[model samples]
Target: MEILAFIYFDPMYFVYVGPALLIAALAQWKVKSAYAHGNKYNASSGLTGAQTAQRILDAYGIGNVSIEAAKTFLGDHYDPKHKVLRLSPEVYQGRTLSSVGIAAHEVGHAIQDFKVYAPLAIRNGLVPMASIGTQFSFALIFAGIILSSWMDMPGARYIAVVGLGLFGATVVFQLINLPVEFNASSRAREILQQQGIVTAAEDKIVGKVLNAAAMTYVAATLTAILTMLYYASIVFGRRD
Candidate 1:
């Protein structure tokens, strides 16, 4: 039973990871609130997210990019691997601030792809490694602790260190991902105003939606960083 007690639930867990957890919680609320507000207001241009995306693509002279409808609400994304931009059903059809803001933001990623953005490339490369680490890093850390504590294993620290290194990949991925998301939002806001998709006053509402979404990413990155710090503190602090 003791061996199963993971470090995440331990007292040190709160000390290292609590604040970031609170930020994540707050960001989720902010996203919902902002999205709801933006959803209530229809765009003056009467263009749905799909149409807005097409206009942005055309303005940027980016052709050959496909825009498709995604099934879920707020599940929109740009798939660089497939050269596809997917907007949620609401965004694809609804003519509202929230819908167009999200659509424009995703198209920002497509724009990045056209330009061969460096961070996006780095982020894509890290996806496979991060996916693997997220699933097993904690288990490896726990096993390393149990082996050292209960079995008196000499190489337990090495195993734990390996887990820490694996965990670091997640942190690196999140850090690189931050700028990518922020830049997308920045581009979205600019083009929306330039094309008169939204008046200057209406653009503020779009900012609310985009900023709230950005905070979620910020919280995720902060959480990953704090988590890595906690793991390193425990694994290396007791070097004997």
Candidate 2:
């Protein structure tokens, strides 16, 4: 019963998850700073983000993909099923280092699709479970806690275990996503250099932008992992 109170106010939970929260905050700041700085410097190629994406697609002989302008800020993504690269207004029209760099990163995912990258496929497959976990995992966990702690129901702890397992899928998805994102950024940097889309010096700025963006994903992964561990410790610590 005392352990159940940790759900609302647990110093140990902070001990498990505090560093991840700090990292997430720092990663977010780094992303904003790098993006803002990169946006100020135009790529020497004089191409808009859309054109840059087209250039990369054409270079790779990947003609099936279509590029579209997205309305949301920082909403850039590659939809492999539809073969569409959606870039935010800033990345689709800005012509700055951040714009083309982000566009190229999305294009990198398109290239992964064209090449049938295994990790991307795995991540895609995990999407359903991850979605379910994101929506219901915590609800189930809290419900189990309520039942076992307040009602003393038999087998209620197993409900929490199930919830934890579901949340584990989300964790696994984030873990697999790290390589996919890093690989896409790697591809973007290489192609940007090979095609001379950015000068050697400008590529450094692009690298910072992409690396900062990757850090956000790293932070998210850490958060998910630590969160799972925190709940696991609580769930398993209780004596039924």
Best by TM-score: 2
Expressed as tens digits, the lDDT of each residue in 1-240 for candidate 2 is 675556668888789999999999999999999999998999999999999999999999999999999999999999988999999998899899999999999999999999999999999999999999988999888888778778888589789889999999999999999999999999999999899999989999999999999999999999999999988887777543
Task: Give the lowest summed-lDDT range of ten residues in model 2.
Answer: 1-10
lDDT of 2 at 186: 93
Clashing pairs in 2: none
TM-scores, one per candidate: 0.95, 0.96
Q: Number of clashing pairs, model 2?
A: 0
- Clashing residue pairs in candidate 1, if any? none
Model 2 segments more than 4 A misplaced: 1-4
lDDT by residue for model 1 over 1-240, one digit each (tens)?
Answer: 344444335777788999999999999999999999999999999999999999999999999799999998789999998889999999999899999999999999999889989999999999999999898898888788778867989589778888888999899999999999999999999999999898898899999999999999999999999999988887777533
RMSD of 2: 1.5
